[model samples]
Target: MEHQSENKDMNHEFLPMTSVANNTGDQVAPGVFVLTTKIVNVYFIQCSEDPSTYYLVDAGMPKSGDMICEWAEKWFNHPPKAILLTHGHFDHVGAVNDLAEKWQVPVFAHHEEIPYLNGQKDYPKPDPSVNGGLVTKLSPMFPNHGIDLGSRIQPLPEDGTVPGLAGWKWIHTPGHTPGHVSFFRENDRVLIAGDAFITVKQESLYQVMTQKQELNGPPKYFTTDWKLAEKSVQTLAALEPSVAATGHGIPMNGSKLKEGLPHLAQNFNELAVPDHGKYVD
Candidate 1:
């Protein structure tokens, strides 16, 4: 799978009047809808037990608080129970502070990510030299700073249970980040695969902007642990998810997803991992 894209300005889509195509607040499963704000994604999940209860997954990019709130109000019938984080990347945690305060809700993350969320640490610098297009080249400018959410943020429970979603489990899919996780529903085999693996070839400019659907690994530039990332992919593939929504690109299902996921798992090093990067051995 190789790309020969015609689009060039993928990151500039967030600019005013840029005419970017958005699939914000689209339901990918019976209860999962992904809210895309530019190149990043946040999810709105409804609990099967109570129609009036829900949770917001990942807060989206900085300054996206208003846009995310607007989408939630327009699409979801009930207020969120809490804010669950897959990880604390700048893009993923951008609007967290604003949303947590406005909703008066607690934010939950893997215990390993607490230091980053509380401004105690920063992720390793992004690898601009990774085998990617403009996105990797420009990643050096992306924020490496952490957000200080104060006492509003807490760790996800260690019992594998998702706060409000009784049937769901938060799998420890670390690699991209030490505490990164993916949410799974065993009965339906549906997955919300934060950045553990995405449905788009994030290194390519056109793929991110066009929202192309390809079962690929995490973003190579930001992923600091290739071996662990590879293991995470295999673990997710083992679940045999019938449908999946990722942090980037479009949600996918059916034969396309079934066949693509296993292929990605089997050949991750060749297809997903970059040959030379700061994070690569």
Candidate 2:
């Protein structure tokens, strides 16, 4: 397939943000690897039944396409068969267009997210009025525009099967975005949680820069519907995932996840939802 064009925002300037984990990668599961690009994460998952098969989940920050490709080549020794998106957020899909064209592979996303990926709609604007710290204060600078993926983007299979990665299902974990989804491998209970629930206090600059490991809701500035976001967190927490790698912050598991996830779910309104924000009801 000829990818004759680029995403409209491919040239967007990189945001001035970094964490201690930037450019670092770690194995969160037998075949699941997480790479931090600036402050966001993109995953490389290897199929359980096939050692040579792998897929990229979520493209990282803007201008990080080459970095992601290099990491993939070094570790997997081959390009992925497909790229799976948890959502169409700017940070998550930043390198998607370039990566798809370079690898000549398909990009799969939830059907609800197709409009944003196809350039038909823009996400709700970020609300800096949300309660938080420097990161939240700087929210308005983050891009909320959608990029055109043209023919390379396709809706994921309705059956929940992830295209190239076997033994996993995509869960509709919206609220962070209307179409936001999380990947779960039932057998091991490993979750690629997108921004449904992250490990860092994304709205706090210090927490973000230091990569503090704390269970928190989606970035408050970008989350439009607290009700749905709350429901989404409840959904994932009930799954009792043994391990989870989110869009930001470090991969969290064991006691932290066990205690924190439930706590966050049980007290979402008090904890995750901002008391007031432009998007908050």
lDDT, each prediction? 0.83, 0.87
lDDT of 1 at 189: 85
Cα lDDT of model 1 by residue, 84-158, tens digit:
999999889999998999999999999998999998998888889989999988899999877789999889989
lDDT of each residue in 41-107, candidate 2, tens digit only: 9998888788677899999889999999888877777789899999998999999999999999999
lDDT of 1 at 230: 93
TM-score of candidate 1 against the unseen true structure: 0.91
